[model samples]
Target: MLIINIHPTETAWSFVDDTASTCSIHHYSKPIPMETIRQESRILYLISPGQNDLQLAPEEQRTVSQQAPHIQTIFRDCLRANPRADHRLLSENRFYQNLPPLSTRYALPADLATRFQRAGRDALTHQWAWIKAKSILPEVKSLISIHLNSAPNAVAIKNGQPVDLSAGFSQMDGLPGFHSCGEIDPSLCLTLSEKGEPPAAIEHLLAAQSGLSSVSPELASFSQIFEQPESLASKVLSHQLKKTIGGMASALNALEAIVFSGEITPALTAWLVDLLEPLTAFGFIPTSTISCESITRLNSPASRIQVFLMEDTPWKIAYEMFSQAQPLQS
Candidate 1:
């Protein structure tokens, strides 16, 4: 089986053998070759961030099936609100679980294929958050996965399923991402358009030029804000992060843990103390930091809620999913 993960920043593929043991892997910063996909002999599966036509697990497929009717209305509302909104968000509600597997004989629709090429790439850190929560506390029922990277999101997990998402309808609606504008009043977008700004230009400004970097040119990544903690950019991000996480934590009826994933670094760990201060009222306290690709507990011993750090990338999870689904495909 061949698994392909396409992101805006990079593209990767792995060819796994029937036994799910070993396979050749290739990842490139350049676009994946169309010819390679067209010519591959093995069955192919795609895992793209923010893609709607996904081959979700059986459970997710069932959820999509039950809720599919509302998607068209959601898409229409988003378009009416933001004329230049990215199609990925509007289209993501559909499930492609029963669709034909990618092969020479079966091709993706042109629009869906283009989204795979343009979707923002993240580690799918929410899934790892759930894994860490389950590992540390098997009885854990509810937790929120906070991903603060190029494309930030907070997902509330309950019983191993997503109960709420901060990146509602689009990745542009959640906490301000490193580059994305996050949410803005529709009136503001309208105001900009009235001032002679093209809708396309406004969309590019919000989607590409806003967020941390928009606050300060040096704030390219989440970690860099720590270098100038006193800067306006740093303060803005801190406030936004705190507000977003607090709301998510408050939403859950039985919050047991909080998982911080995606772009976890030493700077982020060192800053967790101050970052989570407000949340202490919610029974979360900061603890010592451990930097690794594996999941590690980051909450103090006395804290009632568990806090974790998971730095593992999404590729590992994608591989595991493909491996598990291989037999079902047969």
Candidate 2:
């Protein structure tokens, strides 16, 4: 089987042998023959982020560069609400999992989530069209399907489902985002609004202009903060990541391995490991580092848990999804 991953940032295609392992891999360029897809039994696994899983008709395949105001309206609705939690709960449970519900995250309204999904429909369809234009294959076009799986950075398969997600979702209740503020005190939103700060203004500030950039003038982007390790931006990011990973592990009740795949994650590895190892008390350090032209595992002997460095997680998950799905009758 041939697995081609078209991610938001990079693209890679791999040939898988009988053992279901990648045999040969090509990166950032198309090396395979276009006729090969039509001539052989193959599947194309696309990992276009922020795209819906529903396949669209060819006529509906145009992408939108600007998000409609309505979408942001729905996003802003998820921001903050009237204050509710008492100070006692906040003070007593400074530890993760025990922190007040309003501290790190909020329950996103279902209708609002759906609205966001609907708004991105055209964008996802446009992505499929873009991939097809480059490949020039008609036979396997229908084979392209959406993997409902999502995650912040990498793709994780749990309970037979993909866990990929866009920003503003609360998977990382404790993890602060780059420009968007990290998890915050929910009531803070209410207080800000009371002082004449509109809900929309707060949302824009958090989503567009906060986090690392809000902290200091020098750190405007993740790359900027990445370069300035001793700076305050790096310090806060490190703290937030550590807390979030620990909280997630605790909530899930298991911690066996870590896979890092995303636009920025693979690049921020050494820094992430330093932050992860201290809080994690596990003893199963990786005995050897794994690497390949295609897929590989990173992590030195002292680091615990098998660490996989996938070129593209969505593509991997999409392949698994397509392979697992029952074919439809003609």
Candidate 3:
């Protein structure tokens, strides 16, 4: 039985333990499970920071970026409004005082800070501490893997143990995430730092506030942009979709190898493959067909292909391919 703890977004973590055969998966919105409390198992936890939640719109982006200062002001006001709410830690204004130094290169605004503060607080409460506590379980057998978007050295160290990290499925080195600007010039960070940008702001731009959000004007939803596409934004969206499909295929192939090698059952393999198909499709194709070549390329112990054709190109043909497969259960 494998216990997979996946942080779907940088701000949230979900735990899916495959041990019970029934496969119970839980979002980290409440208290840790009793099983987690009792097992004391050394769980394999993966962390990939700087991922985005649901896509935002252009107006939201502009408001967040342009009105960043006002947003920060409001955030501070919110803190001040709740005088008894840990004002000491919140009063320092680190998030605001630290912004200009950070946005020199990326032009971050106050709304981002406010959103981060809110999301970060919720994430810490519902996910991080809970996982940290669970990590001490004696029943946990192994610390198998970790994922991170940035360098592992940057992650906070606690009790001298390095957190296992993976850069997430989207961050395959050069592959851009939903909101990352993707790979940057190596000297870019040095240049930004030398110019006196705050480390926090640099980190924020590099991880949280880049990617699709940078290109699209609408902040609330990428789907909105797709519905009414302009030339430039449409191109960016197309590229991002292609990259996403490639990444999903890569992850699927990796999982398939494990299953095919007898590490997991056929049923589990089928279940995962079916589950991810819709997500990978993203309206580009209704269904996806995995070819033997793609599977072999992805699973080859020595092969290192970064991209592959998972299905026929042209939405019409791809949709037809999807129709031929067993309908994916909703």
Candidate 4:
């Protein structure tokens, strides 16, 4: 089995150099040895092999084509030149066709496009297209995995055991992903969509346009505002920060139990605890310790907590309880 490690920054070919007759030298980069390569070979890994992760605009395309001519050229050359070689290129950006019907470019505002044009272009999109088009090997299955700042809601669980969807979903529920809103108001979505807005626009509003941006107009980032002194806005900001931390902690705990197991080191546990500290301070449910326990307890065959958590019933009770508990503060 040929194992190829394609990084996001550079493309490196790894194969037994059969050309060398005396002792076949393993033709892998000095930076990454052949032994390390073997360790990561249980699952197939593909990378886009680009410098940075940045979405480019239409105008910046020309400059990128000029500067990173070799990136795309190498990709095309690799698939075309070496058809038999088993390799996968990892990318940060999604690719779409440039010509007529095939092309449905990212729908963004003109101002955003102009800003992106000023920034340097990303070679990921181009590399993705080239790989998809040329690589037609029957053995190679095209698997695309995107790593976001947040945790994923779904993950493929691979073991000697049979493939199970229930197991995957159960593992996924604890994780906070980029796409998931993490305790969203279904009524808000229904109300917004009822007004005849497009589904795509609603999706963008929920995913990209909401959160910290919606809350703070003056501040560009949540971290910047988080540094400010206590105020009504700061309190709200604190709450948001706490909630985010809780979600992240829950995700890490779930991942540890289902995937990492003994591999879950002290550093990882520390990171998870650190994330949950703010949430604990804010009186949000302690996520790190009770996350898995809560999932198990709430999802039991005979449990009322599941219904409460699922349908926002507990939120009402919590609000009332808080109101009664701290009347003077309220």
Model 4: per-residue Cα lDDT at residue 19: 32
lDDT of 1 at 190: 92
Candidate 1: TM-score? 0.67
What is candidate 3's lDDT per residue for 53-87, written digit by digit as tens? Answer: 21223345455345435324433543343333211
- Tens digits of lDDT, candidate 1, 48-111: 4334323234465567555554334333533344343222321112221122222111144765
Best by TM-score: 1
What residue runs in model 2 are displaced by over 4 Å at the alpha carbon?
1-174, 263-267, 284-296, 300-304, 313-321, 325-330
Lowest-scoring 10 consecutive residues by lDDT in candidate 1? 89-98
True-vs-predicted CA distance for residue 74, candidate 3, Å:
42
TM-score each candidate. 0.67, 0.49, 0.29, 0.29
RMSD of each: 12.7, 16.5, 18.6, 19.7
lDDT of 4 by residue, 100-132 (tens): 211112245767533332111222322222232
What is the per-residue lDDT of model 2 for residues 105-135, given as tens digits with 9 covering 90 to 100?
A: 3255754433322112212222322233224
Q: Each model's C-alpha lDDT?
A: 0.58, 0.41, 0.31, 0.31
Runs off by more than 4 Å, candidate 4: 1-10, 13-55, 85-87, 95-113, 116-264, 277-330
Q: List the residue pairs that clash in candidate 2.
A: 149-162, 149-164, 150-163, 150-164, 150-165, 151-163, 151-164, 151-165, 176-182
